[model samples]
Target: MRLFDYELSGNCYKVRFLLHALALPYERRAMNFHPGREHKAAWFIEHHHPRGQLPVLEDDGVSIPDAQAILVHLASRYDPAGQWYPDDPAIRARIAPWLAVADDLTGSAGAARLHDAFGYPLDIAACRRAARAVLRRLDDHLAEGASGGARWLAGTPVPTIADIACFPYVALAPEGGIALDAFPALRQWVGRFRRQPGFIGMAGIMAPQIGP
Candidate 1:
């Protein structure tokens, strides 16, 4: 297996995070996304991904682009019990919408991180505001669920792709100037995620497990 990766990209980090959880071995094909813009190269464009995205997965001669799609593919293929993309139709339904929301988090928090940390040009204020909005919604949703004994986003006893999909950007939102102070549930969520076995971290994130 091979992963076309950029170390600083949260999208790329999601793939790496899950791969480590799954204990999958793969080679890292580093991409110079910053000053180099190697992802935009013609060779990568024509062969790897048309959009020049990072964290493209190459396995069994198939190249999969986009982080969310990669997660589904990996879970479906390797997860023997099928818990990540679970068998229940309702859980699957809940998981899909969260993946979409994960994209919004990417548009906001992920973009903000690029702007602040990597000198990419973007509206930092707008990004932070949008991220706060998402965080507010998620915080409320999780809090409401907590009343009914929900432990994960999909209301499952175990964490699902829904949780993993939304985690990295929210965990790293501070790097984008989005603070976690107002979202206590989200802070707890991040801490719980970090406590999960096989959790991994990237730049701007370390193991964030909280005290019990």
Candidate 2:
């Protein structure tokens, strides 16, 4: 398998974290997005994805584009320990909503901030408001539940893809000027995730510390 990714992208970091956690060895082909390298050529679009996005995963000639889809695929295929994803349908059903939340809050909002910080000139106020709203929802959810009440989002005894799905952006939000100090449980959760074996920090991103 060959994974084409950009190092600083949170979406790409999701796949990297999962793969590292599972100890899966695959070739990583880093791509440069700054100069529009991903959009310049037809090769990236025609063979990988028509959308010309980074973080494309190739396995047995099949290409997976979206980060979430790539994560699910990795968990299903390479996780021999069954730690990242559960086979139980009920568990999956419960975990699905949180994953969706991660996508919206972490993925969308995080990307918006990143674009703005890079001088892309997006609507900063709108993105900041949206990100704050999302974080409040997560903070409220964690505060309502007991600390370590559920081992993970799916009520499992260990971390799963859901945790991996959300960690990067939350940890790096300060780079985009989003503060997380008010979210105590979320902070604890991030610490716990960092202690997990095989965990890797999202490298090459500009993240500054925010006061708790």
Candidate 3:
């Protein structure tokens, strides 16, 4: 297995986090996504992702692009316990929308991070506005579920791909100049996610501290 990754990309981090959680060993093909834009190079675009996206996964002669798709593929194929993408129909139905919301997060929060951290040209104000809109909805959902003692995004006992899918950008929202302070439930969710066993961190998001 191999991952074409950019160290700073939240999308790429999602894949890395899950890979660690599953204890899967894979070669890392680190790319220059920022200044060099190696992902946009002709060979990469022709073979891996036409859109020149990072976090492309290669396993057993198959190439998978898009972080969400890669997550689904990894969990479905590799997870023998059926934890990440559970088999229950109702659970899968619940998980689907949150996966879509993850893409929206990539567009808003992730784009904002690129604008600020990597100097990508984007409308910062517009990105933050859209990010807050999504965060508000997410906070409301989590807050409502908290009343019933549900924590994970899909209201599952254990974290699923839904939680992983939406986690990175939300955790890194502040880097995009979108503060998480106003959303208490969302903040708590981020904290809980960070504390999960096998959780890994990227550039902006830190791994949990071991001791005082």
Segments in model 1 whose C-alpha atoms lie over 4 Å from true places: 209-212
Q: Best candidate per lDDT, number?
A: 3
Record all residue pairs in model 2 with backbone atoms less than 3 Å apart, i.e. clashing.
none
lDDT of 3 by residue, 142-199 (tens): 9999999999999999999999999999999999999999999999999999999877
Candidate 1 residues 66-166, lDDT tens each? Answer: 99999999988988878788978888998998999899999999899889888888888999999999999899989999999997899999898888899
User: How close is each model in CA RMSD to the real structure?
Assistant: 1.7, 3.6, 0.9
72-153: candidate 2 lDDT, tens digit per residue: 8999898877777788888678667877877786544686657665766677677777877877777777666546576465
Error of 2 at 16 (Å): 1.0
| TM-score, every prediction | 0.95, 0.89, 0.98
Which portions of model 3 show Cα errors greater than 4 Å? none
Candidate with more favorable, higher TM-score: 2 or 3: 3
- Candidate 3: count of backbone clashes, pairs at least 3 residues apart or interchain: 0
| Model 1, position 76: C-alpha lDDT score | 86
Model 2 deviation from the true structure expressed as Cα RMSD, one decimal place = 3.6
